[model samples]
Target: MTSHQLTAGICSRLNEPEHSDELLSSTPIVQILSVKRVGSTNGPNPIDRYRIIVSDGEHFLQSMLATQLNHFVDDGKINKNTICRLDKFTCNMVQEKRLLIVLAVTVLEQSTTKIGSPVGLQNPPGDAVASPATAQQTPAANALSTTSTAPAVSSSTTTTPAAVRGQGARSGRGPNIFPIEGLSPYQNNWTIRARVTNKSEIKTWSNQRGEGKLFNVTFMDESGEIRGTAFNMVADALYDKLEEGKVYFISKAKVNLAKKQFNNVANEYELGLEKNTEVEECRDSSNFPVVRYNFIDLAKLQDMAKDALCDVIAIVKEIGDATEFTSKFGKTSLKRELTVVDRSGFSVRLTLWAKNAEKFTHTDQPVVALKGVKVGDFGGRNLTMTSSSSLEVNPDIPESHALRGWFDAGGNSENFQSHTNAFSGGGAVAFNRAEMMSLEEVKVKELGGSDKTDYFSTKATVMHLKPENIAYPACPTQGCSKKVFDQHDGWRCEKCDRSFEKPEYRYASTTVTAGCASADPVSSRYMISMAVSDYSGQAWFQGFNDLGEVLFKRPANELVAIRDRDEAKFTKLVEDVTGQQFNFSCRAKQDTYNETTRTRYGVQKILPLDYAEEARHLMELLAAPWAQ
Candidate 1:
């Protein structure tokens, strides 16, 4: 029978000096303990670092007998069984790569007592120590702890060992395939020495679906990346037991197929932590792989065309108003678009939808990171935004600092063209109540031309409304203001129906003023769309039937009558306010019949009113100008 020192060479690789002194001074015999590749040498897969296994008595016990472990088994250097001698070997920490040596010599202390205070046991004091020969066998476990204080190896070396890990095991088991790149050959039941890398504990649920929990974790071997998910029972079983960036030995998984759709995380596939899944915190995590990526440059993306999927980092230069626009998606949501520029000599439009838009409004930097954003051409040649991708703002990254510097130093112009603040020039109506005014306030007023700036405002009342008193419906199609010919089958709105089942009804929402108008002339741009709307209604009315409503229901004559009546009332309202000189602006346009050509028949003309001092009879609110 062979009498041997069970623990051998394992200490020199350790930077700890104490292990050296203890190993050299005492003599208990241990064997050669080295981890090596089992067979072929194609070198470690580029994606992963390495896979190796180490063992001692606890793992060699009873259960492993039936299986022929020789396929993966590689003999270590021969060592003679001994009593008065010591042995030593080394291993590298899987994640941090810190050198750790195991001393397999005898010690005055007993080996059966607790090794390093792993979890449950703490070292005992006093003089109940073992003889020098027995104590030397302890593998320097006394110095090990959960937190490492040793120096880490360079990232350049992410390696794996062969002995106990190979393409196939002798136990008639098929080759195990690791999901990581270059690991397909070992597709059956090959064991991988990996680091937990990242883990999320299971969250128990006792909800409507019954009771259970689901948890996940990310494991990284020297080869590449793979994610694992544990549901219900599995989550409860393992969630609390794992920690991030730790190494482990894994085996006995079903090695089923990978489904990308089931993968919601950035990872490529979803791994199931199944019933046969086996996971053990590696007692010997000698080697492992690490992965890293060279992120794309954001500054270059500024000059890239729209819809181009490129990475980008930029400071929010200016935020525009989030005008409500119906999308083809058939839902009404708020979206704000803005211009962001990098150090390049170009700028692009970024559309922030809903919460992101609102969030941008309140942000100080609005610095955003686009990992894989698609560019788009909008409003002609300008870059537009889309949601097919994702966006992040002010992430905890180094590029953030670089971008901030570029923006602060006027480097944005090099990459982007920024539009001057239009809203600041009074073009925006979002100012305070004092500075802000609605399109309706100046709705009736017509102020236009560069030289013309006789800004005046006053209220009015209803007088004699024109014959345009009837109401009408509008084209339900977005951007298509043409009236629909009633199919009589129902209210068939061809335009909106194309996008939706039903068309939106037009509310000939305009008030035929038998009411007065404001005294000041408003901007011409304001009435342009309105005139188009009105004329379009007339066109709609031509095709409109008794069964179907038109855009404008009021007859032309009726509209003229309301104008005459409303003009008179408006004069009265103005006179009541100014009292000295009262003149009002009136708006009337040829209704749009066809919106396709973007053409209009009649101009948005103004009508003046004839009024007298009798207007003083109308009741009025207190003048707000200087009431304070």
Candidate 2:
């Protein structure tokens, strides 16, 4: 029979002054006496620094297990009485007491029974009493309250381990909670006490990596906020327990770099919970922080990066009727547009989707506070609600109250800069809102000289209309608007490579209007080949089939039939539109036709005259310093 000898090398020599510094730089074999998890304070995501007591049968010393080594305890490989060989360590003097930091360690022997008791009683420097060898191994039951005068190796810069533990013991309220900003992938042993700010529905996915059920949670503390995900068994365990707005004491979650594309939280790191993760509700979480928003002013939204999450506080000046549409997946999606204004004297469009759109109620133009809304651009800057986003209607926050006060004090009546009409959707035409240029000034500016078209609004009376070629056959494809050739059988579109049994008819009208009575002979007539007019001047405007039909309040096919069947009726219709005042949005571009270089003005959009908006524009013009 071979006798087994359990020997502690440097662990026994730890008390010796000479061996201490030398062994601290090198690896040493020791017997583990006990290990305890100490909670962190200061940040929401706090890494737990393990207080480990080791013995060599002759002497005992205290050390801290690096957070990276948390897996050892989690795997049940570093229990009391287990023998381990430290591969790397650092010794730092904290609060005048020397503490050993275990950077790396390997199990030498696994044991469930107790090891030898404390050999000789020697207090660690600055300690009043020596740690008892027979102390209970369970951290919760027999954990000693130890304060760190200094930080552990590679610990967070803002806080120290001993201080956290000491505070917990002295205050009896537990350790200082950590904020989300303090979290990083470099540490693992941490506990986060955070309020669940946002929660996502369970989602399942399968690929080459396999399939599993997962859910996400957004949490925040005083310092910052972060997003976390739990998959498979961990998700099943914690899903029902996670309630939005509830604070929880969570530990043992793995931290990783956040995937910027998917995560909207400002934190650089996110959390992943595993089977060993601990989650306990913090009932007395009055101290826990609520989610904070760093709102971007409404005027600054246009300059921000596209798709960025935006926090904004604004007054709901206008709300569009909710519209329902079927997505490509056949899912019904509801959308509504809201015009929100802020103190910056600017207004932007916010698109609400799904429940936010359907459940929205307009009451007294309540203040709309948004967090984590996705920025969008159609014609100009717009916003969309994301799953992780939240909307507060007339929230009692300071910003909301301030906006309410501002709006009530005649703020909405002020001339607000508008970013929505800056450009038209998917068109080359840009929006011209403030300045009403004369026909000569439009040509001088060469509005549509560039690749993109320039847009301007004008008030003018229609002088004449070229009723010929007023309506044309178009391809019936939903998005394709190419002209189709009328065939005996049907209509064919070269671009679409398909023939339609029945072609959709569209109106493209070329109407001429005079800018001013005293304008130049040739350029005075503002030729709006299509689109609206106000009182400014006539410009060449062209309106497409849909817009033309909208203006005529009749379908293109019906109009075309009337034109073909009754010349007198068509003439009356054309004559009725002529000499009428209208507000028109016109697109200008230069084109060469049969050796003739001409600037063509096309009508892209038409808006019914808003007496208030026109009055505002006129007021702005009158208030201009140049005008004075």
Candidate 3:
């Protein structure tokens, strides 16, 4: 490499907007003097950012590498003494210093020695450097100039607020458009030009502190993406203005630490819209980037733990009819189940809730891309879309187009393996047959001792039942099973805000239970604690309504009535099931109460002894070479 290969003094020319077109017409090549990692690794955004000192042969300037281009640094493609062409970049003033944001670069050649004796650019003679206070008074300096005629302000020259505002207005953007990846709580007077990729419905919440409404929207630029939220009055004002896939110039919003539990955007900082926040739609947004997804294959879902969030793109193999169900809290909700398959030859059920469920009408096997869908383990493995999740039907992305092509060309005829068990959690144990554990093996292996819950199956005989507190008087509401207070006149349910003449009796579980899906408003249920033992050891397990019915062959309400009217019959009923053996699907979870941590086992499903299946399994085991 020689000095002539570098674009000498191009760094100085970038500061002068009058030469933007001339510079844009020809690519500027520069030498990488050095590269250094910046940003806090312990911060909410732990991703590494690189800052490089690039030389135009005559003068050296500090440049920040766009996060999207970090691969160049990591892959050693661009390094010290390497010459590269600056494909796209912008100049910005930060804290009274000129900073170059390198958006795109192309590596040309590598050299072992420096190409030129480049000196650092200093303020021109007699020019006054802007003070920190003066810097704060101006708009962000990263905004790209729309035209070559836009006046340029040197970082060393102090300008009045009016002039800075005028320049921004003349450029048609309120301020310099900051990249979403560069946003932080420390920056002030910065604006971002980005497209809204997704918007959520306004959600209202009530708690001890009162009630408020809020909504979230995801914004994406060429650099990266971030989540923005508006609350209460602000939410009401901006909810209608931020439409999906529209570009806008947003300013005056506060950047805060992201709440990782609520969102899946890669960026670490999120924006909070305030009353004074400015959001102006940009009509000329043809250059804005569309939504990006980090999709995972369906076959890999088995390796992911429950409650993990993932992005996926697959063909809609089947769609179930929308069904209405009352939630445990008495809210009526609608849901639809979708069987989606990918080229990985695996299928998983994707559940859409509320409006998304009711509005889906696609039947032509459209390719759907979902971001932030949660993985579940209710039966085996499934997916559920939450408030932060976004869905696109027949997206134009390369992945979607590839999946569509594959499906149309005989991929639909391929048999895909399902992750879920068809009969699991309904009336029998999982048909997939989870790893069977003995009571003693479960204890020895320390299952459910971790932060996440552990599930397994076992065969155990019922030993005894804890007779006390087996049933409680519950509200008669269709969905609510909360305990009701018996006033002398009537049963009162605080949650329902109503009173009834009589409280319905229900079996009480120590832990939360799902609501019944049956049509009957008032059905008998049970929540009981029973001891079960296998050949190895004995352990206590919590049984809910379904398990209770399977074990006792009767409803909890009848047992409670029998216990009250005839103690002898209830005692006999309990004793009759004591020695019965069955297959149990159970979950173990550790909980802390009063600083005491203990593991609790809950029965998720129960299955009777299948003599024929058992015999076949035994025969297969005996025929094994090791057994022979």
lDDT of 3 by residue, 1-628 (tens): 4533788679777654233334544678999998765432222123556777788878777677776677798788988998999876666555445667776788988878997687766533333354433322323322211000100111222222233334446656553656665666656768777778778888888779999999999887666677899999999999999998788878889988777777655566788999999888866665445655668899887655456667899999999999999987677889999999999999999999987898789988789999778888777678999876788999877888899989999999999987753221321224223258899999998988998767778889999988777766777687677778878878899999999776667543322122332233454557779999999999999876777778777677666767877998888888898999998777788889999999888886678999998896686567433464
Worst 10 residues of 3 by lDDT: 144-153
lDDT of each: 0.36, 0.62, 0.71
Task: Compose the digit string of candidate 1's lDDT tens values, residues 193-241.
Answer: 5666545434455657687778667566533445677887677777766
Better of 1 and 2 by TM-score: 2
| Top-TM-score candidate index | 3
Candidate 2 residue 243 Cα shift, in angstroms, is: 2.5
Query: TM-scores of the models, in the given order?
Result: 0.29, 0.43, 0.59
Cα-based lDDT at residue 240, candidate 3: 93
Candidate 1 lands at a TM-score of 0.29
Error of 1 at 350 (Å): 9.6
The 10-residue segment with the lowest total lDDT in model 2 = 515-524
Q: Where does candidate 2 stray beyond 4 Å?
A: 1-177, 204-212, 320-324, 414-416, 420-628
**1 or 3, which is superior by lDDT?**
3
